[model samples]
Target: MSLAQPAPTPSRWLRAALPAMFILLGVIYATWASRLPAIRDLRVLDAATLGTILLGGGLGAVLSFPLAAWLLAHYGARRAALYAGLGLLFGLPLLGVLPNWWLLFAGVFVLGAASSCFDVAINAIGAEQEREAGRSIMSMLHAWFCVGTFSGALVGSAAAGLGLSPLWHFLLVAFVLLLMLICAYRILPCDAPDPDAGKKHFALPHGALIWLGLIAFLGAISEGSLTDWISLYLTDHLHASEAGAPLGYAAFAGAMLVARLVGDRLKDRFGARRLVAGSSLLAAVGLGVAIAAPSFGVAVIGFVLTGLGVAAVFPCLFSAAGREGPTALAGVATLGYSGSLMGPPLMGYAIHGYGYVFGMALLAVVSVFVAVAAMRARLLV
Candidate 1:
């Protein structure tokens, strides 16, 4: 199944299964993340210790770049995605059963590696599917990921509310996801491994790809910072009550969900460069407003705007990179993953030294930079 030729009409089951992979990926990731506080409390770990544990996941991802490229080159997307997905499912339950922080770090490391590998492969499949269909579907596929995250978050909240143990929650989710994967695998598209892709074990963004990576980096920082800090910001800055703090993130996520639901059509109608530039500018403004907001309600409004503004950047960027071939997409994904790894910790240090407002202000500044870069990036189409 060479991408240069229009692929055979994919089976309906294959098309359905492809999006399911993205959703399952999100469910696994969020299910683990939403349980972080619980795990910390269980182990009686301090902030620094928890941060160290989290760092393991990032390191694992970075280290897996070469391996991910190799897997995609040798095994192709279907086998690579399946193998990595199994690793993810296995790692999830391990996190729940780990006896200590060190073991937990090891589990998270495996999970992260699996996630990075799975991400690259699944996205490769999406790129292929989009090309075969002669349309843009990456945004809608990514939207399903958001759906999974939202669903996973809700499930986590319910489990927590019910006082269900993390072990039980994870086990249940993993079991269900595994069943879904089993069904999906039966119908996933088959492609022979790319012989040409074998020589490159790793990649760095070059030429126009460098700009695409830059956009991904800044966008990731903005997204990651909000996920990591929004609740704390609402609680500390606005004096939001305990029960209300999570709503800030909810507003952001919900807005992103809505934006992505419409993102593909918007991309087709307006072109990637124009849409990205305008949306990034909106994100900058929204983040600035949120950082300076006098009240919680105002902050939530800002977050909503930020979400709406930044939603289309990745799907567009990923689709563009996919056009460049597997290596390019892998390179962009690697760079973007690095930003996700570095953003929160860097912001933590900044906030500790300066203040919360200072840290968030930096994110807003980057959002503006994203806007400017998008306008100048001609190849983003």
Candidate 2:
């Protein structure tokens, strides 16, 4: 009789868990960056100039994405992620303390590049893990990002209350993220890219991926605008107290996290096409209400609706990309992230040119296009 071959060992659930940790950590770092407006004010930079500097981070990420994809293919997800995380860990604390505007720009650029690399590498690992586990888990994975963002807000509020310097606050976050990377190292997958996956040099997105990229871009613009500017909007337009301004973002993020935690179940039960279409319409209505409402309470409710509507869209897009092919996944994620890079600056320019209300109204119109694309693409399911 032939000896029985050992069954393949089931990978630990911790592999899935670690990526969430990184998402959370990255979000915390972003919250730290949001606190930088105050730092910029202290340093005497005008809004337009600060906006220009902010664009540098996006440029760096755009430049880095193709290179990052190649590195992930060659070096494996874990190693690439480790290097990226280390870069972010070092880059975060330096942003506030760098003294010179150019130095600060350089720091933000490195931060953007490193974070983009980490994002793609982690998503690649998550995709592989999803295959191995034989289940849909992408939505829950992203829910953790919302949770992380919420947690980061809390941390930022506390730090602000205590009057901690930006340098010290970011330094603390960096240290924690460093420890997280060390702990997460073992659980991540070590699978190398298929030797025959072909040498497809990184190029600009086109075709269906371009449409997908546009969807991502619109979604990112909406989300980034809310995250980057909502606090100021509430404080200035709605007469919200400084402490209360963050609550607007908290509402947005909290609703998003709750919706995303349940998103996979919703997708499985309701199907992707239905979920995306309905959510998009709901988001459009939410934005409309947000813009039209005279009361802050209504505006907050609108923000919550907006969050719920958007919660599942990005994860659905990511899942769609994964289904496309492993080789294409990096390009897809990069293109999607390019939206993140583009959204904020675009909003900034719009606000500078057309006032905050018009800028937000434009986003509302953009959400309608997202709904239309979801219906037309028919790829959601």
Candidate 3:
């Protein structure tokens, strides 16, 4: 093959291995997220402190953008993914075994950094595959991520109910993820270094990308806040049982999984802008309902709606970014992921001062911003 020819996409292995990797990614994140209440109880941390610790993870994610770019440039997507994945598998157990919340903050920071880096690598490969096949598949791949989180949340609920220690639970999940990672390492497409990666290490979103980033920013705040706080809200505010607390996130992830499974079709039918605008509005409504819920069951129904509402936002936005090329995609993704991962810790302070009600309400308001931003986004199609 001529050097001018782009890398050949993988065979059927891409279909099988890539989605499994996304699922594993989701599982790893949800394993820790679903168990936040237990960790809080173990560390005897208040909301403020827990939020501070969670901030470390968000900081790590934001800071990893350059590192991710550097790695993808030097090593290629597969090894970048492998390295980050190993970092996560190694770091997660530390969250469970840490001596205190202070130490836990350090571990979570590393976790976030690795998680975001892995995400960038995986999406980079997925975009390449989609471009090569001349089709749409980003949504489907992200659907698998939703599947992983849903499954992880359910398993976490069971573990918490069984009175399993966080250390043991993390270890078991990490082992399973390791097996999945091994398989993925062998089958995933071998995209070479991004040709322009060196020059674009610190690229920032601009023009249309800024609008797309805005949508991602608000969408992520809603998504991340719920992932990090919804269960705790169930437990502390609604007085849910240990087993039942995680059900809130399970509902969210499950609903998102179902929606994302069909997200490509929906995006094709309605168009990206319409789908995002409508979905953001739906998320706002659903989150409002959840916040106002009088009982745990009622709150779960709201979370389900919220899940359905936000499901299409990321996939639609990311796919749009892909059309703009990898550099733009990376820039928008960095901005978005930073918000999604980092915004939650910031919300902790608000929740600490005013309460969970305020925190949830703030997210509901932000969902409106997502809708408005999507409506205005010129790059969405």
Candidate 2, residue 10: how far the Cα is off, in Å: 11
Among these predicted structures, which one has the highest TM-score?
A: 3
Q: Which candidate's lDDT is highest?
A: 3
Q: Model 1: per-residue lDDT, tens digit, 43-131?
A: 88655565566666777777886788889898888888888988989889888889887887788788878988988898989998889
Name the runs in model 2 displaced over 4 angstroms: 1-16, 194-198, 293-296
lDDT of 2 by residue, 1-381 (tens): 111211233456564455555564546544754475556656776555555666766777788888777777677777777788788788888876888777777777887788778887777777776677787788888888888777776676667667778888888877876776765665444567646434873655566666666676677667766776666666667887545666777788888889999998999999876787788778888888888879778888998999898887778877877676545676766666766665666776777777778877888887788877776665567
Model 1 lDDT, residue 282, Cα: 91
Local distance difference test, per candidate? 0.79, 0.72, 0.86
lDDT of 2 at 152: 74
Q: What is the lDDT of residue 136 in candidate 3?
A: 74
Write the residue-wise lDDT of candidate 3 on 261-314 in tens digits. Answer: 898888889888999889888988888888889999999999999999999988
Number of backbone collisions per candidate: 0, 0, 0
Model 2 lDDT, full chain set: 0.72
| Candidate numbers, best lDDT first, in rank order | 3, 1, 2
Worst 10 residues of 3 by lDDT: 1-10
